[model samples]
Target: MRDWFVASRVSAGFIVVLVGYTSSAVIVFQAAAAAGASEQQISSWLWALGVGMGLSSIGLSWYSKKPILTAWSTPGAALLVTSLQGLSINEAIGAFLFSSLLITLSGLSGFIDKLIRWIPQSLASAMLAGVLLQFSLQLFSALESQLILVVAMIACYLIGRHIAPRYVMLLTLLVGCGVAYQLGLLDLSSVSFQLAKPEWVSPDFSWQALIGVGLPLFVVTMASQNMPGIAALHGNGYRPAISPIIAWTGVTGLVLAPFGGFAFNLSAITASICMGKEADSDPSKRYLASIWAGIFYIAIGLLGATVVSLFAAFPQELVTAVAGLALLSTIANSLAGALADAEGREAAICTFLLTASSVSFFGIGSAFWGLSLGMLVHYFTQAVSKKKQLMKT
Candidate 1:
């Protein structure tokens, strides 16, 4: 039983890494290309990011005894695709360093900590639910193309959950892979055994690069990534001094910035996999998932091209389905948390809908806007109710 439990936790970690890298790695590549990186430099970029996320996720999860997974800022990567177009690789590196420094200072100042504390729990959960809703919908929407593969994986997941809940995700993943392979959907020709060559480029700072790329990168990463990450931790009942963890990620960014590690922040969507009962019936053991994810991150860093090619072989629909099924429980739990309190229900629901809409403004994602709007609704409603009671009395 103990061995089986350990296996489940381990599988959860892999799922987090799998979903994370395959989902946004293309954007990271585009960001690197925009900086005019050579093939070797692009390999270095992946190596730095993979290792940075691995070390931070493992160290933070182990130290905090919580499933605190770190990820490269997807939005930050997208920002770089356009922002770094005219910048030298050295200038791009400078922008990366500047953004990381600001992130570190934000953590040290405890401003972000205060902001997170001000958010209602219901709204936090609502934001999480909203963020994950798209992935869940993708699971079924995939039926249009890979109907047999999707149906088979879903059927397997449902039955496995009833008979062996701990193995459901693992079972679903294996089923998806097996069926996809049988259909010749996987492209295994690119599989190779080679290491990603790491190259270092010293940064040359300029005001234009710093303000245009650095400052905006900092804003988007903090608002779009770290906030939701902390909310995931809180929503799942894991609180371990998020302020310091945020600082640590910034510190990691500072260290790896020159090597092409643009941004490192807490993971919002993927972290839920490790936090839930699917990882371990005992929440305490779920930290192992992050630890394993860290180990995989390091391996992928060392063999960036090789391992990534292996993940790339899996069909897009397969990745989408597995991610949705793995997140099902987390999504359900988040919804329950969001609506659990009558006083905060309106605020939470609004937050959920806005976040699910995938809205963005000023380069900031919907997660931030949803939380902000929800906070306003909650406080305004409470104040109006108080005023009406006073008048009646």
Candidate 2:
């Protein structure tokens, strides 16, 4: 293990993973707060999520001997932010438990896995492209807000990629920090060190919350988040066992639900960070990177408040630019895969555009709608092609 860590460049990989994961921490907190959670509840949420992600990443990656990472559901977090208005905290906890239970059942029954199997590779790729397009565009779009920071990061990324592709993410992050500090954008005064303590809450079941919030959250997290996450892993040339990962996430979520782990599942964006070449040259050794990530996650869970404060010290724009740049490769790969098949080109285009638009309908986010419409179009096109082939025959 020590040799694996040394060969995989564990320190560099850890820093890269840290920057990639911590960049989104603030937004996660904001989303949790917007979900009607109290400050303590939000703190608990972080604790649960951090611990769940940490343990799952450690156990699964160790067991599978691959870089399998787990993360809180970003879409599910956003869903809670908008949908939990006027909802009780107990009810939200209930919804979380219910969702976790449902996910657990899905993993056990193999229904979800079977459903994913039926989805054409083209459509899955398209859905992934749809999900990630906005994030990719943010690389350039963020320049409008913080030109110097974004430009510096982008330039550093390009230069680093040319010189040392493995350390591009690390170098870009350093550049972002330097640029942000030079511009007086970072506020280090707020930084402090402390340990995070988990606060437990009792779960209360509510039918209203279950139907309105839990079911939708579960569906979106599993479909929009986990589905794309698994696709990303497979797309990236690593095929970790899916059932055990999902089941483990469910188990973690169940254990931490009362403590405020809203939703735990496979990660897409941050996982990509750890699974990429930056983590290791030999793919087999990449599990060490995940093990390192798990350690950081546990540290964050133990020092949740301090971790949040430290991350908050950095300028928002700097983090945004770094995140946007770090994800460029994954986004490009997803786009290429999505449009690879001529038969699904139009449908894929539709999916990409709709998701990038960030439109919302009936309180559900655009990712779901984009996938739905793209699938509809893909099926229709496939039917038409079948008919034409029959005629020719």
Candidate 3:
């Protein structure tokens, strides 16, 4: 037990939790607000999401003996922020339930993995790169506004990368906070110490929300989030049964939707932290890192309101810069994978460009369109090549 609970593993796990909260918790808050949730309901949203993630991460990691981490779908939250217009909280709950049900059905039918397999690796990586490209741009945008804070964080990240790559996010966070403090950017007055309490609301189903929010939510979570998460697990030499894991997340989301859990899915970016060599030299011990991460998630859920306030205290620029810097390595790795295949280069570039464009058609996001179009291009090119070869013969 002591061997598994070593300091480095604990720290790595803690860093994953920290980055998860800091990077996208605000988007969750905004989504709740857009749904017209009361402050109490927002707190409940945090509590539900935190608890759901905690249980899923710990339970799955223990059962599989792998670093199986779960996260609230950040892209889903962003979608909710935009798509919840004219929708009540109850209607949103209905959408969440609908999306979860679809996900569960897909897994049970064994269709989800088959669909994912149909997607070329380059396209999947391209979609991930496109989804994350906005954050990369925001890093520089924040620099333009808060030069010192961003510059300090970048310097710390570079130094940490050179000396101790495992803790680059932690080091950047510490240095960013220090710089924010010195520059009078830290504001703790809004911070408080209060535990979050869950509030339940009965769901009111609407066909509009079901078609608009539910369908898109499921698509983005599956195409943009879960696909990359599986890739991360595979890329890192870990393979667990994908269907059951996804089905379990869907079930958990279904149970918690009424309490403000919007979407639940496997984590790609943060899971990489716990699954990587920095977590442990021995692959077998990495599950312990996920276990520690689960423990921290429970604490965050219990203190959801307080954690929200604490994150709120940090300046926007600080948070933006930190999130961007934390994801820099992930973005680079994804870009490399997206462009890795010589044969798929044209299709992959098409996916990346369309996704990064952030264009929406018929209420669906670009990530979905990018993959769809890329696949079409792939097949079309292949057909043309084959026909030309046959003509030569």
Candidate 4:
């Protein structure tokens, strides 16, 4: 275990947790606020999420021999920001329990795996591509605000790619920090290390909360979060069985939800960082990165608000640039896969466009819409062509 604890992999793991927290930890905070959670309760939320994600990610990656990363449901957090309103914290906990139960059943029944197995690789790749398009684009968008910082990061990535491809992300991260410090962009003076204590809210089950919050959270977490997450793993050529992974996250959520772990699912975007070549040149060794990520996550949970302040101190552009750089190869590979299949070309393109739009309806996200539409279009076009062939015959 200690043999593989190299700096490059450790950095990769840190980047994964860093990206995950920076990207959606704020949303989690807002969701807690929506539920009218007090200060201590909010800290509990962070503790639950961090600990839950860490345990599942490490367990799955080690057992499965895949760089499997788990995350709090960002979409579910977004939904809670609105739907958690007017519901007591106890009811919200009940809703979290109910939703996690649904996810567990879905995984145990093998439905999620079968459904994912049914998706065409082309469309799956398209969905993954669409999901990452924004992050890749954000890299350059950061340039407008911090031209030198972003440029230095980009240059570091380019140079590192040529000479030391495996360490590009780490080197880029260092350069981004250096540039940011030179510009006085970081503010860490207010950061403090305070361990978070978990407080379990006894659940108050209500049909109203179940139907309103529980059900919708289940739907988005599955369709938007889990689906894309599986797609990401598949895109990157890591095919860990989907059912057990989902089951693990659902089970973890069930255990920790009362302490404010709303939902946990397979992570797509941040997981990609751990699975990338930047984590390690050898794919099999990448699991070490995820294990390292799990360690970081556990530290965050244990330290709770203490670490969040540290994470928040970094400039937004630095985060954006690193995330974007880390994911470039993944985006490119997914695009290649999406376009590789001539038979599914039209469907793949449609899926890509729809998912990249980031549209949502009825609390479901664009990934679901794109996947559903892509599958429909792919099958419809095939049927039409077959009918035409029959007519000719």
Candidate 5:
């Protein structure tokens, strides 16, 4: 029993990584409202996304024997928050279906897979590093508002890294909670236990929603999040079938979209956590960790508010600090890979800077634009270099 519990706990680490990547509750609420969903409808949305992600993770990870994760699109969530300002709930669902269908088609048609092949590895790595750098900076910035909480978390993370590197995030969370309790920063009295129930909103498709919200959400999620996620998998020495995974996520999202599942895609940062040696010494055994994560996610989905409230009770700074520290290794590796190749240096640097800048143009985030520009520069430079060499010859 003791050994079994230990195994279970290790499995739970996958869910921890997922939660650490982006607390679902915080983002889901904002995402639902942005899509003009009501309170009840938003709860349903959580149910949809949670179940979708959980099931996809389980099935894909099991079949491929790799750590395949499915997550609600962070980029899509962000897009909805900005674009769903005045849209009706039905229209938003319409947008959801539209984008999902397009995603499915893209996966089936092999266009996205082809596109992924064309990108330089350095540029992809640079884009990933840039996207994550913002979160790392924010971890520190959060300290200004909650110094004691952040400091406690940082101290715990350092100590934990030395003692039990595999469970560093878990240890930091535990120690941070203890400090928060001692400092009287924690409020447990408000915590409540409640299951989340799915509430279905009738589908209403609108051209406006399709063009304005659906298309952009699809584009950004694929470009900014999924692309780098796949790149991370390849970078880390796991190459699974891309089209099937993409197709599966789209199908899951489509089935659950009416219930509040927005966009589901591959996870880069959290997946890496489970994929690493810390999870297990053997790469073949890592899938079990992801399977365990899926189980925990399913439980959270069923428990709903109870689980969300528990995480919400933690001081924000604690979450930020721990997340930042946990990702330090990954960030360093990504940066190293991005700058390693001499030929790709200029283009990779452009990608990194542009993504790090966080600029937005025409409602699109910098991640996509940065990668686009980088690829362009890389291709152009290669062409010119080849031309010059031929002339000299």
Candidate 6:
């Protein structure tokens, strides 16, 4: 209804889409390029990913009345950049199918929820804070390169935070664009308006792809993407059924694999924009922002080629500053939640340090390791406490 179409919700949705594309769309393009996709095939990949995220976002938000945002697995895309080498496009599709099947089976088995429940809230929040600390830190590191641009954006953000809090990111983004244009940082000469068409590739299964690409994609998507996503939701005091959402992402990814939707899952960093107070003060109404995100995603799918040029026009510094500014509040909240519990303070700090380090073991990412390590420390501390109590008694 028109009543739900507030300016803040609309702005939040726009910010979510902006962060999604700016953060990792380039990496996704590289993955497709690595898989030997032609221009048309690459366009179809964007089309499939866009459409898959769009429809699933809309449907899930409607069904749950929560701001359930979906995204292409950025970590999975990065994995493909390395693991997908020497694999044919058809074989890559087979790997995608295998990953989706595993995601679906994990959801159906209800094991994911149980595993998530075992993770302490402090540890989860710590991992999210650690994951996001990089972006917030980027704000200052960027000043070294583009002083005026970063300073102006930060000033605008501080001013907007005090005056009109709901539109802080929107205002900051506008200021960044204007400043970038004045500095001659934007390059729009290559920009074009073109609609993308989908091109499907029939899958050819191979055990090599299943082992190399599929397993890695499934693990990273679950560990890196969905884990923080669920943590973000819990940190914000929203608890929806996790299994069904994961299953929907699986089904959606499976449906769009041939068209180049490598993987789809709950978003971590970007979803926080929609889940936070920036989206809407009333949690019940925040779903509207996600609906708007879905609408923008469908438009992005339709205007696939144009998106490439559109995003390219802005300087890299501008994009990084804007995303960092947009997430400042969320990062603050995540860190606060992470350190709130005294019992798990040490464990949480360990998680934060490990995750922020960005170290990886085997094919898995730092988020998983951070959580695993923190949980181990927490259990060890609890056992010690129990033994001490018995000795005292």
Clashes of 3: 0
Q: What value does the lDDT take at residue 96 in candidate 5?
A: 88
The whole-model C-alpha lDDT of candidate 2 against the native structure comes to 0.75
Q: Tens digits of per-residue lDDT for model 3 on 1-393?
A: 677667657776776777789788989999999999998999999899999999999999999999999999988998999999889999999999999999888878888767767777777777767766787689899988899889988888788777876556667777888999999988999888988899998998999999999999998898767876886676566778799999999999999999998899998778877776556668898898898888888889989979767877888888777667756765677778888888889998998899889897755567778888889988898999999999999
Global lDDT scores for all candidate models: 0.92, 0.75, 0.84, 0.92, 0.76, 0.88
Give one digit per residue, the lDDT tens place, for model 4 in 1-393: 575767779999999888889888899999999999999999999999999999999999989889999999999999999998899999999999999999999989998878977799999999999999999899999989999999999999999998988778889999989989999999999899799999989999999999999999999999999999999999989887799789888999999999999999999999888888888889999998999999999999999988888989999999999999999999898999999978889999999999999998988889999999999999999999999999999
Report how far off residue 207 is in candidate 1 (Å). 0.7
Question: Which tens-of-lDDT digit does each residue in 258-373 have in candidate 5?
Answer: 88777888887677666665566577777777777777777777776676777777766766676666566667778899899999999999999998898988766788898899
Give per-model TM-scores: 0.98, 0.89, 0.85, 0.98, 0.90, 0.97
Model 1 score (lDDT): 0.92
Superposed Cα RMSD, model 6:
1.3
TM-score of 6: 0.97
* Location of the lowest summed lDDT over 10 successive residues in candidate 6: 1-10
Ranking by lDDT: 4, 1, 6, 3, 5, 2
How well does candidate 4 match the true structure, expressed as C-alpha RMSD?
1.0
* Residue 389 lDDT in candidate 4: 98
Give the per-residue lDDT digits (tens) of candidate 1, residues 246-291. 8899999999999999999999999999888888888988888888
At residue 210, give the lDDT of candidate 5: 89
- Per-residue lDDT, model 2, residue 63, is 89
Best by lDDT: 4
For model 3, the superposed segments whose C-alpha errors exceed 4 Å read: 1-27, 30-36, 78-92, 204-216, 231-239, 269-289
Error of 1 at 151 (Å): 0.6
Which residue runs does candidate 6 get wrong by more than 4 Å?
none
Model 5: pairs clashing at backbone N, Cα or C within 3 Å: 45-259, 45-260
